[model samples]
Target: MNLLNQTNEKIIPSLFLLLLITGLFSCTSESELTQVDVVVYGGTSSAVIAAVELAQSGKSVVIVSPDIHIGGLSSNGLGFSDTGNKEAIGGLAREFYHRVWQHYNDSLAWNWEQHSDFGNRGQGTVAMDGESRTMWIFEPHVAEQVFEDLIAENKIPVFRDEWLDRETGVEKENGRIVAIETLSGKRYRAKVFIDATYEGDLMAAAGVSYHVGREACDEYGEKWNGVQAGVFHHTHHFQVPIDPYVIPGDPSSGLLPKIADEKPGANCSGDDKIQAYCFRLCMSNHPENRVPFTKPDNYDPNDFELLGRLFDSGWNEWFNKFDLIPNRKTDTNNHGPFSSDNIGMNYDYPEASYERRQEIIQEHANYQKGLLYYVANDERVPEKIREEMKNWGLAKDEFTDNGNWPHQLYIREARRMIGEYVTTEKDILGERLVPEPIGMGSYTMDSHNVQRFVTEEGYVQNEGDLGVHPHAPYQIAYGSIIPKKEECKNLLVPVCVSSSHIAYGSIRMEPVFMILGQSAAVAATIAIDDKSAVQDISYLEMREHLMQKKQVLSLND
Candidate 1:
């Protein structure tokens, strides 16, 4: 209930003053205030658009978020978009793209590069005019600007830095969410609630069902499900077998730090683990905004000796991966053996508390930063590779607040809600038909490496990387977003919707989230009218609304 500063100093004065100002300036209409049609609990792209849609439809709404920076990953450092099918996007989701286009209307937005070089429209992501326009991909600041414009246009009340109370704060009465309380003890009452968090923390706190890691192939009848020990791509696990034991070929050095200590669970069993996480770094070649990588206080180059071993083992194909973002910035994700992805290091993060989560985040930062610093400085590194790595530096304009680290990490999959309709691998493979259709997802079933361990031949191997294609964009089920009808009837979740780990790989794209967010709002409006649970809302009505909004629901595309 108390707001503590980073130094643990009680910020009672400013907290009280801000509260007083909000109270005095707050809308006083008992009719104009109190209840809203919906209360979305994240400032993510989906949440923002949901609020915008409902408000645009003349419904009242509010967004409560723990992050002061809105737009979640979209507005954060992930400007290099993971848009599977640009044609699948529509409605407010596509409008977000248009807004980005509007930003480029001014020549100044292209400060880092020539507008011509920026290209014409995003690759294949068509504009509403049915014209090819370069709008889907954008820079960090550009994305934030678009989201801010939507918020201002809608006038939706956004309470920043409001951490939800996971226990009793989600007061459900008569199978409906009445109000939600944050960590600061402020209660926000509403007719319906939507959980848009990536972790689905609020959804779970509301007594909704959810799942956390990969389901064995048998559990979900999925080909790409479970431990993918035999699969290796983009990077070499070992043309030669790596020893899973301790001493390299000796079996006595004690398993190197990164390898698992136990027999990795049977290939097809459910486990509480997820793919490795790493910062979706936005590095700028621009001298003005770039910051050189720094040495950490706990600068232990030995922690990354595993990578050094990989380099020595003849794996120097660097540019084959590390996706490019824009304006001299790179999304620079995890690639190569022991690169940026902090594999096997962040399993407990999905459910950890703020302090604990911060610890994990900081540890990851140090680990990743140390990796860069080591590659750029360590004499152990191949001289040629070190010179190539040195050319890359942190983008200056990105992550200005933190020392050039991304505000968000590529949390590939986490806390998936067990909703009314669970989207399994069958949905992606077209083996099982989903009855309720809200939006569509058509990317391949993709889960990154969950754990990295030394093989029997003393080489490091990455496990749980599933790349089995679903052929084309598949239909994401409405059931995936709604919890079991019996529990919390009115709540809808999109980002953390129900899906097996392998199945979620396809649904977990930024464009899909935005499309789902728009669909979630349409459902919200319907739920308000019917005075029923989100699950009870008529799919026929919902489908019509979505078509009106231009959200691609069918796989016909």
Candidate 2:
């Protein structure tokens, strides 16, 4: 169970030997070295889009990814895209959707269900738009294939399953990153680097300043920034008075599982707590394609005791978020109280070591699996609910390598880089015009429940669920993607941009990530041509390039 110790004892030694050998043979062997114009460090949607942009621009780029699979949450199970203003999404992001549209137009893509039978329902828009030639929703496998096709067509080299050596991996000279070495001892030399990871691991390892948790409203001069103790924008909170104790009315008994044994923090104050994380499951209702929810190893029924209590409290809205995708499958997300989001369990994940992070990931996987099994099989679950739950299982075709479970965890929020410009709620609300626009974000500012804590009334309640819509689609500034010149001159972070916690809630959409990724690549090219730092790149020139690439930088465009 001590994953860190095991990694240190076994993996570290072998990695060290590999590093030593690679260092000794550094001058002679070309296999250990790769030189590219840009090294995008991640396999997320943004990483793929950035690499493709660089390739299309005739620049050599490579993706050094920690994931075995490509496309992050987009290919995982987030097929129910959270697109705000679809028109605001253009460039490579829209191209990705257009490719998805092209795929579904073929009859072979609709194997489980007929294309005509599948209704055109999406998140506040049509699933498929014939006029725009874009499909906003799709299956996990289809999204993955689209990313793979883009990589293949662009001829971008990708090194899969290569983890960054966070401690001594990056070599910087005169505030510029010279090269970066992975744990496998392969060194990549690049003029510009893009960190497209959800966790911002490379950005953190490169000594860039970042924030892990929510900031106080005062810090950013904004509402909905910090620990929202009383705000409940979503229905994920306890509606009725639920006892916190294990035994119904006994004061001697301890608190129920998953309920924090502390007071909900002061409202509008800063806290080092992160929003919950969960796996956006891709499930199927089709009998032929369904893989019944199986009982996971070490399954304990007591873990879901609170959920059973909730069921007893007359809450039967568990099926509210089974958003349907193509091929009779669903992009299942965390919905009701005591659902998939493991509240207050991922606070350390943003800064944890790789081994420690794996432990956390495994723990979350077990918790979710146990919850599913409990709801589907346990006698404590209502008979009506159990019968319906039994019909839906994991899709057999999706994530074939990982037992039909999602390969990527829904990392809702993580280490956000405090780069040259920090995007606050003001920027998202259009109170202040963003300077040097690169991309636009129009999604509602949303955050899942952060903690399940006991109220003063001695009842269990969830906190930190927030949803606020912007006045209009807001432009993202170029400064948000680049690090401060003194921190790192040649690095860009598109996924984990420089933003406040609340502002990030709006910016952290897949399409926006792709748009920013393409814009980052354009900025990288500008920096390279001008022989200047990423901070010093000419915004006017970069804007010209972005427009030519068909990136939607403004509402007027």
Candidate 3:
């Protein structure tokens, strides 16, 4: 390798060049070092909102994102936001929806469908409220544009395609992160740091305590913590007595692909398994901007044999949650039995290597695409259902870079920080009161199916599908976002806050993420001002700052 000499000339095989480089072999240059007041990792909606809040507070912040896009699922195909209580949503989260409302108010946004034709279908409130003028459901591109506008308006620096060096790149001093080096040879030094990634990569790299999977019910003294098998509140599981074997009545023929041969564990027991993941497909029926669903390259009909058996057994709820948005597009989520959710395929995603994670993502994509193709084209499907499925195709204008596919997958839950305070089912259901309110979450304790295994009586069943409801809007504590006092002094985790697996199910909504993002930024600024650890900052001061920014810290606020 060649290096620059003292005269700024290229030299090879010289001790002078080695000394100039400052190491035996180093890929990074001092010019790539960035100093900022705050360094926010991950490019989710929370990251964008936190960076904006930091910039508004006169702090230099940089967003280091692994993905190409900024907004995670909010700008990805989850246009149909899963907001439980609109009153619980305030601050930058509400501003985002308000901007979405303003976009649809203009006549030019109504290209595929007329403004009058796309009526209000949102829950909890009127869709087109001339009063609040906040539209919840919208196209994917509109949400991305809104997030982009937030970054542009605040002049926040965002570095995309920069993966953190998880192994040895984090430089720490006195229980605080001094700087972080990325895989692209870029280093960032900051006084404060916020980890907004759904996977909690930065927090884990900082040696923060975190849990990957479910906790036993006894561990948190909560009722809904682990291994829930027969609780079928949603219609996402198999509804029919379909055989899971490759052969109808022959056990020697072996179980079908993707179905585990082991028996499912007892209810409420802990395991390392995580919920399934799927792409929030943006499907449209508008012929002008619809790309007909095409079969993926690795299409295999036998891969979806279980779904065919479900259809043959009279379980036909193919369109349970095809939530429609503006511009005739749909936020097509995993609906009925054997829908878009690729079960038992993403168990190792939270801890997988970068290359392995990419493989898992591609596997989920192929599974979902094959499911759509099977519904639209397979001869074995019911004729009427197949015809209806044929009507919906991917929106052409959305996700233009990836052939009408979302850039990010829905990572429902990952490494949750076991910080100073842990939110549990009691906190979510209003049984346990939470102090130091920073934000609120009202969504149901919802987790997708985790494992597909054989039952005791020789039948296939899914476990870990939970849908319990919270009593009311509950406050998330300030201590939940900060790491444990002994682990890290300056880091804050908003997305993967300290919580039980079931509590995280409720706190994992996009709006709650943005709310906590704002709260985390305020807390970081307070810590920086006082020159104290994040855990040592005053909760009341942080709350006052959040309230000034119109953030609803508690239900009473």
Best by lDDT: 2
Question: Which 10-residue window in model 3 sums to the lowest lDDT?
Answer: 1-10
Native-to-model Cα distance after best TM-score fit, residue 532 in candidate 3, in Å: 0.8
Which digits, one per residue and each the tens of the lDDT, describe model 1 over residues 1-557? Answer: 11222221122556435544654223344322334568899878888888888888777777877666678788766765666677666788878877776776667877778766754433334322226333666777678778888887776667777777776678888777787877665677777788888878788888888888878788767667777777764453545455544456666767666777654676777688898887777777677767888899999887867777777767786554455555766767666656777878889888887677777788888888898899888988899988877777898887678666667766777798877777888888888777877777777676777887665545667788766677666777788888888888889898998888888888888878888888888888998898878888899999888888888877574
Better of 2 and 3 by TM-score: 2
Give the poorly placed runs of model 1, Cα more than 4 Å off: 1-34, 118-130, 233-236, 242-247, 555-557
C-alpha local distance difference test of each model:
0.74, 0.90, 0.86
C-alpha positional error of residue 294 in candidate 1 after TM-score superposition, expressed in Å: 0.5
Candidate 3 deviant stretches above 4 angstroms: 1-31
Residues 122-189 of candidate 3: C-alpha lDDT, one tens digit per residue = 75566666788788888889999999999879866677778888998799999999999887667888
318 in model 3: Cα distance from truth in Å?
0.7
Error of 2 at 367 (Å): 0.8
